[model samples]
Target chain A: MIVGDRKPMDEILEMLEPYENILILGCGTCVTVCLSGGEREAAILAGQLRIWGKKEGKNLNIMEHTIQRQCEKEWVDEMRGHVEKADVVLSLACGVGVQLVAEMYEEKAIYPGLNTTFMGYPVVHGTWLENCRGCGNCVLAHTGGVCPITRCAKSLLNGPCGGSQDGKCEISKDTECAWQVIYERLKKKDQLDWMNSYQPPRDWSTAGDGGPRKSVKIEEVID
Target chain B: MEADEATSTSEVPEEFRPRIVAYCCNYCAYAAADLAGSMRLSYPPDVKVIRLPCSGKVEISYLLKALEEGADGVMVAGCMEGDCHFMEGNFRAKRKVRHAKRLLEEIGFDSQRLEMFNLSSAMAGRFAEIILEMTERIKKLGPTPLRKGVKD
Candidate 1:
């Protein structure tokens, strides 16, 4: 899931200073799972904004709404009425959702309320760790399940660099060495021979190097 | 939502009294408040006690909504540390209170208006003292700046 963090109150307030009717749109997918931008968060932010407005003597009208997925057109289209009512929109979704909403609205001034952090999963109850870099390549077959591209500090194709100490990365003691984890995992599965197979340099072109990347769905009918 | 019927004590003027909401867990703080009442301990009437199953149930929104809806001060009272009936409920509440405080501060509101207290069910006198302390603190701070027309 794509994790996000709410932008500071100061930044949000500054962006909203000129607007009176504000719509706080929250996405219920990834942002909800990460507890950053969800229905509850949208409502909380609306409340905070209302309180701030009262204190600052601003006659602000704020509406809070959450859709199942802001990235999809159908879900965003359903909120057309609410969108049209507000003078400005504060999107609590990720960058993808925010862009999709902006594209759909075209004329409305859409602003992001969250800083889209990374494609990660919760390692613990409250801790999330990035596990995939979406390098446009699959190397899990050669290495273990761990992705060196995301977990490794250096993204070494073949690693356990000079900084791998006591199974921890050189960058931080809290970070587990991806290469160490890969080695240990493969060793446990009795597939250490795969380590001897050297991998060539990664191709960056497919990973949005030239421009934006897209995956078109090609439908096939049964003969 | 269980506020005292009396808005102010006999000495303080009604205008000077602050509207405080205290969320007390049934296992400890609520019991302590009850004991204080039975013992005839006279605390200020500014505080209104709302009972909860556990302090951990006090969500951040509740604290924010309290202030947003005209509460001058808010308090979350739970079991003493290491003595939570649900085991770690108070600890969770402590963290939530800290997070709420940060949120309040970030919104340019006074974080001092929100607080958390921990005491056993047997601490009747301590319950009265906590109320008095919160009441005095709020008195010094004055009414919440978030008050609708007053600030506007």
Candidate 2:
């Protein structure tokens, strides 16, 4: 899932200074799973803001609402009433959700409340680790299930670089060497020969660096 | 309830009396408070106790909302370490309190205004002492920065 973190309160307060009626919009999908921008998070932000407003003696009326998925137009439409009532919206969704809302509400001021971090999942109860680069390609079939593109500090294709030492990445002792894990997995499966297949330089076009990426379900689209 | 309005009708002196919200876990701290009451022990009246099933159940929103509603200080009192009736409820509350403290600091509020305490149901004297400690600390800190001048 897409992981995100809430922006600093000082930044949020500064952006909200000019607005009176503010709506804290939360996404119920990715951000929710990451424990950053869910309905509870929306209420938490609203509570903080209300305290700030009262302290500053500002007449700020804060409202909070969350939708199933902010990137979907149907879910975004459900917030039309709330969007119309607020002078500004602080969207606690990923960059995609923020843009979709901005595109739909051209006349309203839409702001991002979270910094979209990466495609990842919680590695522990409260810890999340990025494991995908969204390269628009799947290399897991060749390498073990480990993603060297994200886990490796250098994103090495044929890793266990000189920096890897004792199963730990050179960058941080806390980070396990991705190649080491991959080597072990492949060795266990007797597929160590796969590592000999040197992968060529990646084509950048498929990655986000080329441009905005999209997918169209030809059969599902009508018109 | 409006704490300020509720206090306005009291006969207490006009000095700055900080309003404090104390979240007491029913399994321990609440019972300790009851024991304190039965023993005729005296503590500051400024501290209002809100009983919860477990301190673990205290959400970060509850602590922030208390401050938002004009609480000068907030504290969560639960069972001592390894003594929680719900196994790890007090432990969870301790972590939540720490998290709430960080959030409070981020908002530019004094994190000292919030605290967590560990107690057993038999610690009646300690319960009163905790209230006095919090009340004195809040009094020294004066009203919450959020409640300094806003007329609710």
- Residue-level lDDT of model 1, residues A1-223, one tens digit each, is 9999999998998999899999999999999999999998898899888777766667889899999999999999999999999999999999999999999999999999999989999988878999887889878887778899888999998887999999999899999999999999999989998788887897878777778888865575344
lDDT of 2 by residue, A114-215 (tens): 999999988898899999998888789878898988888898888889998999999999999999999999999999998899999877678787678999
Model 1 local distance difference test score: 0.88
In the predicted model 1, the residue pairs found to clash are none
Encode model 1's per-residue lDDT on B5-116: one tens digit a residue. 1222233445677788999999999999999999999898878999999999988888888988888789999999999999999999999899888887686777888999
C-alpha root-mean-square deviation, candidate 2? 4.0
Off by over 4 Å in 2: B1-13, B148-152
Q: Compute the TM-score of each model's chain A versus the native chain A and list the values.
A: 0.96, 0.97
* Model 2 CAPRI quality: acceptable
The DockQ for candidate 2, computed on C-alphas, is 0.47
Report per-candidate DockQ.
0.40, 0.47
For model 1 the interface RMSD, in Å, equals 5.4
lDDT of 1 at B57: 94
Q: Whose DockQ is greatest here?
A: 2
Task: Please give the range of 10 consecutive residues that has the lowest summed lDDT in model 2 chain B.
Answer: B1-10
Give the winner by lDDT.
2
